[model samples]
Target chain A: MDENPATAPLPANGPLDGDPGLQPERTALAWGRTLLTLIAASAMSLRWLPDQGPFVLAMFGLTIAAGSGIYLTQRRRYRRSVEGIRAGRLAPDAAAVFWTAGACVALGAVGVWLVLS
Target chain B: MTVPSTSTPPPGSVPRRSRFAEKILPGGTEPDPRFTLANERTFLAWIRTSLALLAGGIAVEAFTTDVFPEPVRRGLSVLLLLLGMLLSAGSAIRWLRVESSLRSNRPLPLPLIGPLLAAGCAVAAAVVIAVVVLG
Candidate 1:
């Protein structure tokens, strides 16, 4: 039986032997889409806040800016990873764990508050 | 114990180390895919949590009457929104870090934000409770 390209391993230092453009682009798009969603959600929250309009707007703006920065950074990171794989020198990122754990704790706190309050 | 000898390779004949496995698990070894997938899932869960926080902030600001002053409401909303954004952004960053770490065969990074977040939440919760009790 022929092996599935999606599951089959490509030789190191070759073109990304599977979906290639489609898969990487899809992953990148997923990141972009999530960022945009979070940005829109933040805007909605900002809009709802009363009186401190300018402050809220500023915070939202900052959040959007941060999101954009993160998005661009992820793009670069992924691109580098892809290139590394093609070049047979893939390197793992070091900061990803802290960021994920931090976000989890923050969100968990929010969840706790929402449930208790 | 009985010894039997067969020279045939296993049926599914995966190479000693495949390229995809190497990318997924660098260092010329295979780690569990489940771990990687779980990490990704956790990150997504955090993003969802961020969204929920944003929703809660909006709800608080939009609903509720003079039970809380407008300024307080706005403050809470901004806090929640900011938290959401931070959490989402942080989660993505962490995911990347973890993924890379797994590839490079390093110990997972220690979690520093957890304590800070917990303290912040405790303070925020206490304030909310005080408002509820005093108002």
Candidate 2:
């Protein structure tokens, strides 16, 4: 909640009372946690990585790339979020969200295949 | 998968009413940012579950399956992995749906996948038990 009595028009400012558009910050943190989980899962799955030659290795590379992309974009996302917050028109980060989910789906598919084998 | 961050609505930019935005967002108005953030958190929560399921699936095969008969073990692992895949995809779709609702000032959509997940797991558990008992 915004403790700033000086700020005008509370409801217009953000969703919650007194919150000065903290959505971006919160979303960025969520992104951080998501990326961390992905990386941890990826690392944990390493031991389980199938030795099916190049295909499995490719999976490993793709997973790492997803992690890297998330990592590299962290700051940029936060920056854009802040900008959006101030602009009073936050554009959605549909791409990043979808990408992260897609990566997990791919990993899950691979995991399923691994199990079936 | 990336939402194009290219649209910069200038402060107090004329509220442009378009069929596209109207179709995506529910209330016909831009939602408070907090709701958007909440939607994002929900999406991440789903993704976390997916990741957990994926890890669990692999761990089942890699570590826990030694005692299980080959087919039983493989079946369980596959089930978990499939669940993960479903969760991951479902979460993404739900995220988009909620975001649109928030944009339109519509009531947030309750997740449809929760019950499906519960039922899916129950069915899988039933299979697991039957495989062990009947085999």
Candidate 3:
């Protein structure tokens, strides 16, 4: 009962009570930039439509889907980050990062195949 | 307000860590949020680099139809696309390694991307130069 209220923990549901670094906001923006890049790549894939046929179209669709997924989840991630900081705990999004990496590798391999054939 | 807090936590209180976090990054005290965010940004930057490289590959294939011979064109395109693939995979692995290191309080691992990308780009340049000179 003698604990200093000033040094006590903030309420769990309190508004973003810590992290002045704006790290979460910056991270969210970084993800947004990544989504933008993916969309640009999708658009670029369309340039190969006439020659590469439907394969490039499929790639474009996939890229768009991935981009959309990122856009949709960004808000949740941002909120979680804010809460995480306040709670003094945060988990990295490993699955998303790995999946994105996997998609890039697949796209690269497909690109190689398309060019060779 | 977004004031930075270096405030000491009350004794006997445990930070609320998630089970998933424990599974992925099992130990060590949580590092500063700033560092984690920075690491995430670095990973995203690498992903962008991969996409840019893939775009370059596709551009070469799509636009260089008449400028270079078929064999050279295909080879160069393949090289670039492969580089993109390598970098994407490398970046993902690097992110995990770094995150784990951060969690464990170990020194971060050295990135092999700089050397690898440099060598690959040099080779690509050499190939292009040879084609331009000989063709």
Give the winner by TM-score.
3
Model 3 TM-score on a 0 to 1 scale: 0.84
lDDT for each residue of candidate 1 in A1-117, tens digit (9 for 90 to 100): 434322345548845522233434444555565567656655654443465566556656765665676576876745543433232233333244334334334433433343233
On a 0 to 100 scale, what is the lDDT of residue A5 in model 1? 28
* Per-candidate DockQ vs. reference: 0.07, 0.31, 0.47
Stretches > 4 Å off in candidate 2: A1-22, B1-28, B123-135
The stretch of ten residues in a row with the least summed lDDT in candidate 3 chain A is A1-10
Best by DockQ: 3
Error of 1 at A5 (Å): 5.9
Error in Å for residue B69 of model 2: 1.3
- What is the alpha-carbon RMSD of candidate 2 to the true structure? 7.5
Sorting all predicted structures by TM-score, with the top scorer first, yields 3, 2, 1
- TM agreement with the true structure for every prediction: 0.47, 0.76, 0.84
In angstroms, how far off is B34's CA in candidate 3?
2.0
lDDT of 3 by residue, A1-117 (tens): 534333345567955546767788989999999989877865766777888878988888888888889999999888767755654545677778887888888888878887777
The alpha-carbon deviation from the true structure for residue A115 of candidate 1, after best TM-score superposition, in angstroms, is 23
Interface RMS for model 3: 4.2
Q: Model 3's DockQ?
A: 0.47
